[model samples]
Target: MTLSNTIRWLGMLAVIGGICRLLMTPLELMWGTDNTTALIIGGITGSVFIIIGTAGIYLFQAEKAGVLGFIGFLMTTLGNILVCTMVMIALFVNTALQDPQILEQDLPGPIVPIRIIMMITMNLGYILFGIATIRAKMLPRWGGALMILLVLMTFIPYTDYLFAVVWGLFYIVLGWAVWSRSKNSETKVSVTQ
Candidate 1:
């Protein structure tokens, strides 16, 4: 298949991924950020879809995105991989903790550091990527801005469900941007052919 088709497929995946997260909003409202079944399932699956979408977005504008966007893409991709690991562990660990024998509230010692790193890298990655998107002018500035702003908005006291709503919206917007880019790319490729 041509590169344009590949990107279009990725954009579709991104939208599906965003929808997966969007559906989780109701689950989170009912479950409240715990390692419930819905979160565990959604988190891993959505992360996988988003990761592909992540690469697609960058490839969609690589030339225009430049060095900054490259770095941002790397950081965000790595951060996303880490999220899958963390989420998986959270489910198993939470299950074990529920028994009468376990008392710990968090993951083991080494994981604490890893989790911290994940947050730092992901946030910084989003910021850089967002900046690159704005500079590249290939996609909407708000998409990039949302990438940065969403993390910053977390400082406010939003509940689990509310955060899920906002987070879902962010991904949906990103998917729209990617979808748009892919369509434009297809048009260009076809016109040239």
Candidate 2:
């Protein structure tokens, strides 16, 4: 597929991944929940999101996107990968297999630093990326602004599901924007021919 088509599909995948994250909140409440299943799903979705987010950053024409976009892409992609892997290990191996109570307790010393770093990178990176996207003017400004807002919402307590859904919506908008733009470009090309 062409680059535009690839970006469109990746954006769609990101939307789906965000939806999966929304589902995870409810699933976690189920009694005798299968952590393994959650981990597998989370890992897959997170991977998809990472790809789309990373690609989205670079897909913005480099000259216009600037240093902020590049930094955001690196941090966002790396943060997602690192956090997803750590979460899987924590939930599946550390808490599920070893001690269920571990989830209730504070993070262990080794895990604390990782969590801190992940939170900063993931949140800050997305915010920067959103700003960069808006600056680049390649996608809808509202979509990029919404991305920044959604990440900010994650910091609020008791709003996990709400933010996840909203985040998914933002991704859906982004995907639509990418897909429609590609389609429009193709139409223009065909018309010119």
Candidate 3:
């Protein structure tokens, strides 16, 4: 496949992932506990899609193989993988804990460590991915910059909702960029022909 096609695919994946995570926040907030099924599903889907997209960009050296893209891809890959791993661990923990009520508890014993691990890994992963977005032409550089901001925002205490909103905005920007770029390309090709 062409490099542009690959990038398009990757861009689509990011858009999808961003949207899913954005949507999940509300579900998580409403439930006030881990959405094990959603988390696992999103983790798997996001990882696969991102890998394909990142690989495409790397394989094609999209944009002269800028260090920014490479760094961004590295961060995104690591961060996304970490988040997925955390989700897997949470699933296992939830299953093994055998206490459905554990969800209701605020930071239960076994969950404390998991939560901490999740927080650290998750934030780091996002930071990296946000960086990757910055280096990509798939969307506006501002989207990536905003993603970086969102990543920073996550560090604030009791601001998960704020994080979610910022995160959603990032996706909205990315999605628009991807959609518009693809359309522009198609138009250019048709006109040339």
Candidate 4:
């Protein structure tokens, strides 16, 4: 398929991902992270779609996005992938198998540092992506602004749940922006023809 087509489809997927992300808050509140089903639906399966969606978001404006955009894309993708890994570990290795000690007992080296690094990269990545998105002007500017502000919000105490809600809204706006923009451009092309 053409790149444009791919991006449009991915944007649709982003809508799906956003819905799943919104569900995360309620799922966590209900199941408290122990339910594997909730974990998978809330983030595991959703993350795959989110990665694809965000890739489309970046590629949609790669030309205008430039170097900072590229770096932001990399970090954003990396952070998402890393979170997926951690979620899988939490679900299967920790929950299904019920081997809480296995992670600490069988791990190679210290994992605390790695986790901290992930956290740092994740926060920075979101901020970078937000700035890049705004500068690119391909997606919704408000969504980009929301991304940066949401990262800042993470610093507030007891605001963890807010993330799922806001991020869901962010992706929804992003996807809608992509969808509408492409459709508008296509209409213009047809009119010109």
In the range 1-193, model 3's lDDT, one tens digit per residue, is 6545655565566566666656656766766456665555444554455445444434333354355556655655665565666566666767788555654567645656756665665565556555665554545768767767876776678876666556656655665565457645731111121
Total backbone clashes of model 3? 2
Against the unseen true structure, what C-alpha lDDT does each candidate score?
A: 0.74, 0.64, 0.57, 0.75
RMSD of each: 4.0, 5.1, 6.3, 4.7
lDDT ranking, high to low: 4, 1, 2, 3
Q: Which portions of model 4 show Cα errors greater than 4 Å?
A: 97-110, 186-193
* Quality of model 3 by C-alpha lDDT: 0.57
Q: What TM-score against the true fold does each predicted structure earn?
A: 0.85, 0.75, 0.66, 0.84
Query: Which TM-score value belongs to model 1?
Result: 0.85
Error of model 2, residue 42, in angstroms: 4.6
For candidate 4, give the lDDT. Answer: 0.75
Ranked candidates (TM-score, high to low): 1, 4, 2, 3
RMSD of 4: 4.7
Model 4 lDDT, residue 106, Cα: 43
Q: Write the per-residue lDDT of candidate 1 for residues 76-183, one digit (tens) a residue.
A: 988888977877776666677654223244656788888888998888898999899889887777878878776787676755566555555666776777787677
lDDT of 4 by residue, 1-193 (tens): 6667777777788778877877888887886644566668867877777777887777777777777877888887888777777677767876757764565564555466666666777788888889989997877899889888878887888888878888778887897777667655631111121
